[model samples]
Target chain A: MERDDIIEYSLDTHHDEEAGKKIRKKIYFVTVLLSVVTAIEVAMGIIWGKAHIDVDGMGWLTIKSIFIILTLLKAGYIVMVFMHLGDERKSLRNVILIPYVLFIGYLFFILLVESSFIFYVKDVIGWV
Target chain B: MAGEATKAIDQAELWGGGRSPFSVSYGKMMMWFFLISDALTFGGFLSALAFARHHLEDAWPVTENIFFHFPLTHAHLPLLYVALMTFILIISSVTMVLAVEAGHRMDRKGVVKWMAFTVLGGAIFVGSQAWEWMTFIAGPDGLLSTSADNASLTSNPYGPQLYADFFFFITGFHGTHVLSGVVINLIVLIRSMQGWYDERGHYEMVEKVGLYWHFIDLVWVFVFTFFYLI
Candidate 1:
């Protein structure tokens, strides 16, 4: 009786037609958007490389920065939209996502400090 | 007739039931917990990758040159393979959703058919990933060289060590997840065909597996952007 009851319970909760359709549509839209954005990023890379556009006297850095920003934007969209985290309860979403954001931010800080230290050491001391 | 009987049984079990401390279904709750832990694992990997990229002293490989390689033509094209990967994953998610819908209708045959397609899609995606990995690890033209005299990292004509490292780590992690997902789907698919869930009359397993499959596809979206586009 217990095993049969559990199996019945599983069957009752298994099917979700409406929700499935909605999620499918959402996934398709997000996929199209991701593909389009990828194409744009690649095109931008090509144009930036070819034009040799100098933004505030930083050519490669400006291009790289723009690329990074766009990539991060796409990543955020994927997490929020396709993952359905955007629709989840704000509290629950924050609980799962906030720590990740903070940790990644902390990582960036460490990278910046360490990279600067390395630059100073190499440039000042003539050390490779 | 059986549907009504099943509903009555559920109500009896719910209201006449001894209270279970956990209100939510076990499988659904477990899926959520799994996703949370998986999120943290991916976050840690990405952060470590960023750290490595920061400390490396060389230009990161441009995504266009490294990943954009065209097979058989020797032409470097960007985003094409990743775009294909994205489509494969997205289509698989769609099929999984369809399977869930079939499960809802108690259309056992529908569930089996859709699930088989979903498994095929997953297998294809993994194969594509394996090909991508081969391209990455072998380097272009099979030659690995270091850029600077002091640099210990091996690189090729395509890019830098940091690029190769992150490419391998991030994509490899995601690929492993996809492989596991395929296995899970296979199990569910076999069970569905075996009338295991059919007799019980609920396709919640399909929904649960769908959730996991969709999550993998979702993660790939971010990975494609960060590792290939950026």
Candidate 2:
């Protein structure tokens, strides 16, 4: 019969003081990294606000690309560290991430190609 | 007997059937799967926004102008308040990871303390969102008959009606997630306090709740980039 006090696994079995310290250190490091990236994003927004949107050019696209890259970097760190996805097996990581990369890339590809279907392409029919 | 022995060998060579192939708890695996589906759902929302933005091009509302209001002051401080919210969410994510780590050590009090901080951070973020929505509704007035900064599902003074619609839908959906996350964290915090998981011999529930919470924060990073920054 199982007793009320029986803990199947010992309370101290998984506890490693060194591991705990490392985890805490990693948490603080990731937190600061995310904050710094966000601050950079905000600074870019302030610098480009009202000025860039009103004037349409390649510069706006460049700034946007920067934002997207930074955002993805932040997402990667969060998933790997905060959610412990990094600790999972290689097969598990691939199974989870591959679909997202393939599908989301396809979505954005159509976003560039198909979404502008109405616009004039010089190859198709120029001079509206 | 030979056929049965061969079939058992095939099973052993492939999946093994006894241990998890993923090397994670069944519940954690389920949470990961659920988050995958949810991420796709959010991808749809953001992609829809992208479609509209591309179609409208320059006519699209500049995010900085539309969301520039800061509370209790007349200053037009674009992206500052939203940035504050982002930092709060990130810091809370740190506290959540700390709580899960504490659970690993079976330090119940540590779990409780950090979980309380996480809960408070989530509540403040949700409250900040509410203020933002209210400010969005009571938008700017005057300057043009097309009006200044007001927004509604049908009307928008800034750019197009589509702007208001997408804003409401994307941020609204994410805010709903945050609200639900807050509620879930509160429930988990109470259970941790009550020694519910200690009796079960594991604090796996905290870990599960933590995965959900971090997922919420993860989605917010995307929303902030796609909606506001880009």
Instruction: Residues B55-137, candidate 2: write the lDDT tens digits.
Output: 57657777787788887887989999999999999999989999999998878999999999999999999999988877786
lDDT of 2: 0.81
Model 1 TM-score on chain A: 0.68
Docking class of 2: acceptable
What does candidate 1's lDDT look like per residue over B1-230, in tens digits? 22133344444444335322133345655776788788777767765666555555345555666567655666656667777787788778767766776777788999899899999999999999988776766666544344232222354445565666667778888999999999999999999989998776577778777878877876776676556654
Candidate 1 reaches a DockQ of: 0.23
- In model 2 chain B, the worst 10-residue window by lDDT is B1-10
Native A-B contacts reproduced, model 2? 0.60
Clashing residue pairs in candidate 2 are: none
Reference interface contacts recovered per candidate: 0.26, 0.60
